[model samples]
Target: MTKWSYDTNGTPGLDSVHAHALVCVTFSVYILAQVLRRQVRVTGLVVTKFFMIHVMNLAMLKLEAGVWGLVFMTCTLLYFYETLPVRYLPVQEKVVLITGCDRGIGHNLAKQLDQLGFYVYAGCLQKGSEGEQELVRNCSSRLTTLQLDVCQLEQVENAVNKVTNELGNKELWGIVNNAGICFVGNVETMTTADIQKLITVNYLGPVNICKAFFPLLRKGKGRLVNISSNAGLAPVPEMGVYCASKAALATMTEVWRYELQKWGIKVATIIPSGYKTGILAYDKQATAERWWRSASDAVKEDYGKECFYAKPKTEALLSPDLSPILDALVDALLSKSPKAYYYRGIFSRALPFLYLHLPTTLGDLVMKVIGDWFISKPLALQKSSKKF
Candidate 1:
C-alpha cells in the first residue's frame, strides 16, 4: 500500500486522502463565505444558492469516492426532484381546522387557507377575542370561528362536534395542531407547576385535539400538520421543558403517520426557526421580571439577580416575518405528496442537518460553540470563578 506522505516541496501531494481533505476544506470555506455574504440568510433555498450548495456537496462526494458518498449523492438527487411541486389538491372542496387561531401562526394560516378557498374552522382561545372577531369580520362565510382551548378536553371535544355537524357532507380535510407556548428559564429554577403547564399546553393539548379529530381526518383521509420548533430538534439550555414537549410532539407525529397510513391520512411536522410569534414573549424585560419573581430565594441566590434581570442588548434573533412558516404549512396541506418533515425559516434546516448528519463528537462541539455564543454566562459562575 502507498502510505500517505507529503511531497518534497512540503505540500500535500495528490493522494486520495489529501484530495478529500482539500475538497472538505474548500467546501467549508465556500459555505462560510455564502453564509456571510447572505447576511445569515444562507438557509433560504434561493434557486442559485441552493443549487450551488448541492453541486459543491456532490463535488466533494465525488472526490471521496465511496459507497457512503454514492448513497448521499443519490439521496440528494432524489430530494432535488421531490421539491418540484405539481398536482395540488383542489382547495374549494377542502375544510381545515386550525388551533391557536386566536393569534400567531395558526391565525395567519387560517386566513390564508380561507382565502385559498378551504372552509376554515378557526379555533380561538376566547369566543369573542380580537383575533376571533377579526377573522369573522374579514374572512368569507366559509370561515367559522370556534371557541377552543386545546388544553381542555371539553373545549377540543366541543370544537370537533361543531365542526363535524357543520361539515354535513364534506369531511374535514386537515387539522393543524398549532396551539403551543414557550417558557425560557433554567430548568433548575422552573417550578413544577410551570413545567406541567408547559407540557399540558404544548404536548398534551395537541394529543387531545388529535384523538378527538382522528375520526373526521380518517373520513377525509386528511393531513395532520404539527407546528414544531427547531428547539425540539436541537435542544438548548433554558428551554428544556419547551424542547421536551415539542420533541414529544414531533415523535408522535411520526408514529401517527405510520399508524394512520392504512387510512391514507398524511402527517407532516413543520419545524420552524425562532420567529416573532405570539407564543414567545416580545417584552424580554417583563419576562425576566416574572421569572425572577417566581424563582425561589435559594435558586435566586445561586444564579444571582443580575443573571436573570440583565436585558439583552438587542431583541432576540427571531424572524419578524412568518411567511416562511406559512409557506411550509401550505405545502404540507396542499401538496399531492407532502414531505414528512417541512423545515422552514432561517437555521431550521441547518441546525437539524448539523445535529443529525455530523459525527457525534463533532456535532456536540458545534452545538456547544453555538450555545456558548448565544447564551449568557450566569453571574453566579462569575462570582465563584473570581473567588478561585
Candidate 2:
C-alpha cells in the first residue's frame, strides 16, 4: 500500500483529495446550469434555479469523503448527458401506426402526432364508429382510420398489407401498440376465461402486432412503442390479472429491445397509470358487481360479497389530460436515442422502486397499508380468528 503523504502547505492527503472532489463538483454544477439553461430555452425550462442550487450542494457533499475523483467526474459527465435537452426528429414524412385509437392515449396520440405532420394510421376496433369518425373529422387527410382488433391475427395481417401498399416506396416510422383491455378483480374471483381475455388483448395482442410488423419495422428502421402500465411493475390490489398481463408485455418489450438492437430498430415501453382512459371502467362498483356475479359459488363463499364491494366507486384520481403520456410516446418514437422504459403518470416510477428496492417484508407492509386505505377486509376474513 502507498503511504499517505502530507502537503507542504499543511493540507492532509485525504483533505486535498476531498477539496479536489468539491472543486470538481462545483465545476460540474456550473456546467449543469449552462446545460439546463439551454434546456429551459428549448423545453420551457422545467428545471428551476433553486433546484440547480440544491443539486449542486447535494452533489458536492455526496463524494467529499471519496478518494476517487475520477469516479466523481465520470458520474458528473453522465448526469450532464442525461440532463441535456432532448432532440426530436422532424415529424414531416414520417408514417406512424397506432392501435386502440378508438379512445384514450391512442386517440390523443393519433391526433397529436397527426397535428405534428406525421401520416398517422389510427387503428380502431370498429371502423366508421363515432371515435373513428371523430378522428377523421378532426385530423388532416393524412390520417387514415383502419379497423384493427389487435386480438385478431387476420385483421393484423390485413392491416399490414394495407400499410405496405400505402407505403409502396416510403417507410413506416413507428408502431404504437396502444391497444389493451383491463379487468379488475380478486385473483380467485377471476374466471379462467376472464384471465384469458386480459392476456389475449394486453399481452398476446402486442406479440401478434409486433411479430407481423417486424418486417415493416426492419424495413423502415423504425421504433416500436408499447403502452404498458405502472400496475405491471408492482402488485396493485384488485388488478391482479391486468397487472400480470402488463408485466408479461413489459418483459417482452425488454427482450424485443435486445433482439432488435442489431437491426437499428428501437423498442420502448410507456409505463403509465391513473389517466382517464376508455380501458379504465369509470363505474368500479358495477365492475365489482360483474366480477362478484361471475365468481363461482366456492369463490363467493370464500371471499364473501362485502369484501368485493370495497373497490373504489369512481376513478376520481385519474387525470383527464393525457398530454404526459402522449409526450412520452412521441419521445419514444421520434427521439434519436429512445429510453427502454418511459414512466409516466402518478406513481409510475415510484411503485417500481418501492417493490424492487425495498425489503420484501417492508414492501409488503407498505403495499398492504395502501391497499387497506381503499379496500376493507373481506367479510369472511374479518369473521375468522386468523390474521393475514
Candidate 3:
C-alpha cells in the first residue's frame, strides 16, 4: 500500500488513503447538512443559526478534513440534544400520594419525594410496621403516613377523603399506585381463591384507586403512575397468576391514558424487571410445598411430587439499587412530557422488544430454550433419564 501524503494546506497530496478519507469526510458533511436543515424546519430559528455557524466553520477549515468531520459530528449531536428528556416541573407546590410505602420502592420513593420538597402521603398496609416507622423517623412534617389497603374499596375511599381534607384547596399533584403482591405457582396448582387474591390486590386495586382519585388528578391536571412488572410483558411458568394480574394492570393503564387525556391527566405505567423487594423475599420452597400439597390427587399424580418439590437454582437477578425505578416514577410524576410506559431493570426493554417483534415460532423457540436453561428439570426425571 502506498503511504498517505498531505500538503502544507492539509489537502491530499498523493495516495488512496488520503483520497478515501477526504471522500468519507465530504459524504459525512453532506449528510450532516441535510439532517441539520430538516431539524431547522422543526426547531425553527435556533437550529438554523447553529447549523449556519457550523457550516461557516466547516468552510473555513476545508483543508483540514478531520476538523470538518468533527464539526459535522458536533452539529449532528446538537440536532439530538433538543430531544433529551430534561424538563422538570417544580415539586415544592405539589402533593403526591404513594401506595405500598411499607417497604421497597414505595418506601424509598416516598422519602425521596418528600426530600425533594413535595408533600408526600405515604400509604402503608400496616400503620405501625417497621418500614412505616422508619419512614416516619426519617421524613419531615411534609411526609404523612396513611393506613391504606388498596384492595379495600372503603379504605381507598377513606384515604381519598383524608387526602382531600388535608389538601383543602391544594390539588393532589399525582398518585403512585405501587401496591401489589405476587403468588408463584403453576396454574394447575393455584386455587380459584389464589387467583382472585392476586387479581384483587394487583389489578383491581389500581383500578379502584384511579377511579376514586380521578377528580383530584383532574383538578391538578396531574399524573397517574402504575407500577407493573416485567412478568406482565412476558409470562414465566410458575408465576402465572402474578403475571396475569400485572398484564391486566398494564392494559388497564393504557385504556385509562386514552380516556384521561381529554381531562389533561397523564397516565404512565412503569414495568420494572425483578428488584430486591419484599415481594420476592418469600420462602419459595415452602410456598411450592404448600402448592404441591393443595394440588388435587390426580394433578399430583400427573406431575410427580419430586417435580413439584425440586427447587430450581435461581440466581440472584434482583437489582440491589432501586434508583432506576424511582427515577422513572419521579419522571412520570414531574417531567413536562413523560413517556406512556417506562421499563427498568435487566432485559426489561429487550425481552419485550423480542416478544413483540420476533416471528411467533422464533419467539416460542427462544422462550423454550430460556426455560430449559433457567428452570431446573425434575430431579426424578433427571436421575431416570440421565438428561436435563
Which is the leading candidate under lDDT?
A: 2
Clashes of each: 0, 1, 0
Better of 2 and 3 by TM-score: 2
lDDT of each: 0.78, 0.80, 0.78
State the lDDT at 252 in candidate 1: 92
TM-score of each: 0.77, 0.82, 0.76
Could you report the Cα RMSD, in angstroms, for every candidate shown? Answer: 9.2, 4.9, 8.4
Which stretches of candidate 3 lie above 4 Å from their native place? 1-83, 306-315, 372-388
Candidate 3, lDDT over the whole model = 0.78
> For model 3, where is the 10-residue window of minimal lDDT?
38-47
For model 3 the TM-score comes to: 0.76
Error of 1 at 94 (Å): 1.1
lDDT computed for candidate 2: 0.80
Which candidate tops TM-score?
Answer: 2
Ranking of all predicted structures according to TM-score, beginning with the best and ending with the worst: 2, 1, 3
